[model samples]
Target: MVRGRDVILEALENLNEDEFKRFKHRLGTQPLRKGFSSIPRGTLHSLDRLDLTDKIVCYYLEDYGMELTAEVLRAIGMLEEAVRLQQAAGQV
Candidate 1:
């Protein structure tokens, strides 16, 4: 199975330069700054899109830390999105 990091990386590869910049800017909350160093820029954008508040990111990063790696973070995020999608579909 493809790892989460791979999924995130794949997503990054697909974005145009402007899109990528927008992604980065979305993550500008000060609280998330600590994690900004651990993850790659592309993954940062993904987190931003997910709208993980600075507090949430800090909480998760504090507990799990940067060890999540690129693949794992992507995988987890994708899984969360999938679950949300499934739930939304069920509501229809």
Candidate 2:
């Protein structure tokens, strides 16, 4: 069976660039409540459209301090890029 990471990667690979760009933009502008038990319905719906699993979505929300584009890199296993983004965000 595929691991969750692989499944997430596969889903991400299929995301069209334009859609992902719009989603990232929306995520950046939205304010998330702490702990991520729930989020704005619109954000949740957008995540669903991106085919992000609940775990991945939760990870993004919990680490919402970083930009969504950066989280996308991290989620897709681009550690170096994610680190760069973290540094850019002053999280590192």
Candidate 3:
């Protein structure tokens, strides 16, 4: 499953500064999906989520047969909402 931890893990596996920066740019933007935004709100610290999401995407595409589709991004957005739900319920 594509999770935030997975994102952090894969990116660090290679540890290339320039490539990481490039990924950050590509996945950083408004509306979230275009920039590989997984979290629902595009606010401060949400970029952190994007950075993680980017890594997960990279890994998923490699091990599994998948592309960075807008729909897929949107679906992941739902997962972010679930986190908020858990937090709201004081579960996080």
lDDT accuracy of residue 8 in candidate 3: 39
TM-score of each model, in listed order: 0.35, 0.32, 0.29
lDDT of 2 at 16: 68
Per-residue CA lDDT of candidate 1, range 1-92, in tens? 43333333344444456654643543333234344544444546666433433423454442232222222333434444334333333333
lDDT of candidate 1? 0.39
The clash count of every prediction, one per candidate, is 4, 0, 1
Higher-TM-score candidate of 2 and 3: 2
Clashing pairs in 2: none
Q: Residues 3-75, candidate 2, lDDT per residue (tens digit)? A: 3344344434545666555545544555445654434555545564434545444556323534554555555
lDDT of each: 0.39, 0.49, 0.37
Model 1 poorest 10 in a row by lDDT = 62-71
- The prediction achieving the highest TM-score against the true structure is 1
Once fitted onto the true fold, the runs of candidate 3 whose alpha carbons sit more than 4 angstroms away are: 1-4, 29-92
* Cα RMSDs, all models: 10.8, 12.5, 12.9
For candidate 3, report its TM-score.
0.29
Q: Model 3, 39-88: lDDT tens per residue?
A: 33333233444455554445334222122322233343434433333333
In candidate 3 the C-alpha lDDT for residue 6 amounts to 47
What is the clash tally of candidate 3? 1
